[model samples]
Target chain A: MTATVHRLRKAAPSLDPMLALVAGDMNAVNAVILDRMQSQIPLIPELAGHLIAGGGKRMRPMLTLASARLIGYTGTRHHRLAAAVEFIHTATLLHDDVVDGSDLRRGRRTANIIWGNPASVLVGDFLFSRSFELMVEDGSLKVLKILSNASAVIAEGEVNQLTAARRVDLGEDRYLDIIGAKTAALFAAACRIAAVVAERPEAEETALDAYGRNLGIAFQLVDDAIDYVSDAGTMGKDAGDDFREGKMTLPVILAHARGTPEERQFWKDAVEGRRDSDADFAHAVELVQRSRAVDDTLARARHYGQRAIDAIAGFPDGAAKAAMVEAVEFAVARAY
Target chain B: MTATVHRLRKAAPSLDPMLALVAGDMNAVNAVILDRMQSQIPLIPELAGHLIAGGGKRMRPMLTLASARLIGYTGTRHHRLAAAVEFIHTATLLHDDVVDGSDLRRGRRTANIIWGNPASVLVGDFLFSRSFELMVEDGSLKVLKILSNASAVIAEGEVNQLTAARRVDLGEDRYLDIIGAKTAALFAAACRIAAVVAERPEAEETALDAYGRNLGIAFQLVDDAIDYVSDAGTMGKDAGDDFREGKMTLPVILAHARGTPEERQFWKDAVEGRRDSDADFAHAVELVQRSRAVDDTLARARHYGQRAIDAIAGFPDGAAKAAMVEAVEFAVARAY
Candidate 1:
């Protein structure tokens, strides 16, 4: 590992503290997740369990739980809402695997690989529907509106990404917009709804939304950077997957913007799926490094990370508030 | 058409009068549909319009409208709810086409065929999320609960069907369970929600649900039987699509049960996907006919049709009630 990576590993706030703080609520959220995933069709549970039971970070639901507690929510509805958040995230992952034709997720065979694309897609739908049910049971139209709108935005982002994929000319603004819709929108909603359920004022709701939105952006930026820097084992997917899939993430877009004419042609060929050998990947990585794309990507992530911290600064100092602020830092640090 | 079909068509009450009865409300529903489908991304509206703008019977949404009118509702929330119902149905159709590898729907090329599977799946998700947004906007927790639960059940039924696909030994009860989850559940929810939004008594809600549930069962039964007896032109989808996909619809299941040893082997080969030629389809049809599977399936459908009519007998006589009764008869008559 690089010195930066070593420093990141040491300096980043451990999620263990946050997880410990919310252990009871997180436990309840997990129970709700397990209970809601059951269906009369055995395969529904079987396929869904394979994905949901896999040891994902549970970061989104953790955000919901942490945000709810940060705002002093004492009700059990946040547990259901957290579960709903996770279900929506899980559902998207299942569909994303199908869309990307991925064979593995979180170091296990993807559900699509095990059950085929049809089952994955349908099960994803089931999880999504189940998420709405949980939201309804929460009995807050404001919460429902936030999460439901986020769902639509997420789908819109996926479709927008599809349109932008393999296009060398994609701009950074468009890339940011795509990530905002696909990833940050849910995070924003997850945090905003915590305030809604707590009956917090609109200002707090907006502040929490801002915090989550910036954190989500930072998270995705780091994820994209990690793809360029990390190996298959560390990334939990094949190295250079975004490149192979023609995804126009930040590093590629930045590299393309900074490349010479021949280098630009190289990126265009790679993104259009004309270049896909190990040697080609190596050359692409070298070009990206030569253009300092990863460094630039991380800098952008840090910018968002700082904004996330700023967004939550008005909240009273507490364990939940401190962990949430640290989460933004950790999101950026993960790239190193 | 056969003589029996001709006679059935003549005796069946026309839906045109029903359609005309709620034409204004349906027009409002369509406006909501058109408005919600719009997105700045451009491809979303384009792809969704291709499917939604293509003509469909709009049966489920009509039930929402009719049921609301049946319960003497004067509010406009049902219009939004009806649009939400159509969005859910359309979303399912998009995903279903991908799952079934279907190229045609409603006598036109399917969205997946025009745009790849990824676009279709993502857009379908967009529509689903949009559906939830509409439900949330309606601001009725009961409406949200009914629709959300139906969505989950529909997905569960789809997964069940996936598990049961190509299995020659699928039982009648299992088939009923599958259809109940996938098709009838939504129908039941759509009608029940009309009562909910109208604030009708629980008994009336139960009655409307029963009416929709039986109507949906009869509708699907006729659909399955039509696949065996009708041509592609009449069926919209290619004839024998279920057989080609090795779907264990009621006809195939019953035929498998009643076949001779040799005939059973034929079904086994066909259902196991070892038979897919024109000659195989012809022979499979012959076996189904010899075993009287279509006749039996239609008989069962008629029984459900009668029950659907019986379910709504307590409603006061009116044009809406008359139209709904005709809908049940119309559902069964289509198979003839």
Candidate 2:
């Protein structure tokens, strides 16, 4: 009679190799980020720094740098573009905190919570404008096109999510579209610009884009799944936070789809903001587990992760590719 | 007994001539605006149209078009750039409404009021991103640099104003800086981009830029002055709205500076949110009038208006020049 250990991940899939692959490049991005975020208006840097200095994994920029390595490109043009990508991501996060009224991010108080919504909104605008300036400085019309279009898509997706909020009938298809625009658009743009800066062929750009887009979707789904995992080990995300906020994510969608009539009513009530207490959340975890919603969510993640790895399969099989593959695995396995 | 009209303007000083000058070009610009404001998300157009079609003067875009005419630019490139300028202006207005928590704009319910702040914010971001898409489409790095830097300056100005809010000690110099960034930066960029598209000389570009910058500062000063006028005819700006919101404008700065000790205390109380009743507002107006703060503010606007006219004096004396000069006079005289 021995206790069983249920580990969902294979060995220790980690971002360590990817971090090692681009550690020096990330430092350059950090410097660009710091230099560009500054303003004579003190509040700009103060509010922007709160989130930039907070513990984001720099995944989007890291993708840019690693993709460059995959192409065997030795140019430094990718550095500015990577910083621009990070700035775009940071702008989105700042606005998201305000739109979500979120108080905590990466285990610290959100900029909106600390600096107020107006400051957050204005600083986000500054960073966004600064991103375009950086792109223009890079002097690549193709890169500008990719990023400017991506920015518009991300904003459209944000509005899509806002309208879909608190709705019990948001199907998986629309949910996919929403996340595709809001989350994956930037990811794709970040990777695609690396190919553009490297002067690679259109095929390479499209391939890297596919890689980032698929990984972004998988990463977001696992993040959604982690919200219901009672023993979640993630640093900033507390379990049941989304449940309390009536956030519409895939696990809830799947659980509601497979639920009994009474359980369905429970989910509807919870989503509509009636049932949000600890007992209700506990019951929610139980329901999702019994229905295997979280498990299936992670399973879905792995499917996309495979697609992500395959997207870049044509590139050389070395440290860059291996680290990228492991990073995708790490994204999907974080829920464990 | 004959009535003393006491009109501040010398002649009619209407914008009709400028309107007539750019009527054809503006139609092209309006088409671009309507076409580009659209998105698959119906809400984007709906929310944006509430302001875009809701009776804005389209002053910024008109500057672009009219500047092109002044520079003898025959290409249609300025049309897209003009629409882009309007998009940036519209985006800023939408966010401004949200930041101010404004309920009404141009006498109609604000988008933020009707669609919610979240919609307004996201739509503003969408339009901002869309503006960049237009710039990228135009494929002018020079124009992109000018507009993007203007955007950053505008955001910085907004944050500066936020930090300066409710401070009676906000001096006239800082007030100029705030309005310069928030209002004049875009005007200068809008005018300068016309020169870029026209491939004009740097001297001509600088001339157009100075003209627009001076006019913008004058235009904003008049707008600020209108808020204190007992009979402000500007449809959108309500008298005492700024006073109630503790907004730090030149009128308050001057009125505070020249006040008696007791009057200074009154202003401090008003700016600090202690005095905001209807009667209190009436008293505040009286204090500013007695100090001649409103009159002095208009005088300052006239000085800038004169400079605006003089900056473009070097341009050929033609219909464009006359219209532009009249436009400046019209702006400075609007409070009448």
Question: Quick one: best TM-score, which candidate?
Answer: 2
- Residue A115 CA error for candidate 1 (Å)? 0.8
Which tens-of-lDDT digit does each residue in B171-240 have in candidate 2? 9999999999999999999999999999999999999999999999999999989989988866477898
TM-score of chain A of each: 0.95, 0.96
Show the lowest summed lDDT stretch of 10 residues, model 2 chain A.
A1-10
Return the top candidate by lDDT.
2
Candidate 1, TM-score vs. the true structure? 0.95
Model 1 spans > 4 angstroms off: A1-10, A230-234, B1-10, B231-234
All DockQ scores? 0.82, 0.78
User: Lowest-scoring 10 consecutive residues by lDDT in candidate 2 chain B?
Assistant: B1-10
Candidate-wise lDDT, in order: 0.87, 0.91
True contacts kept of 1: 0.91
The i-RMS of every model, in angstroms, reads 0.5, 0.5
Q: Give the lDDT of residue A163 in candidate 1.
A: 92
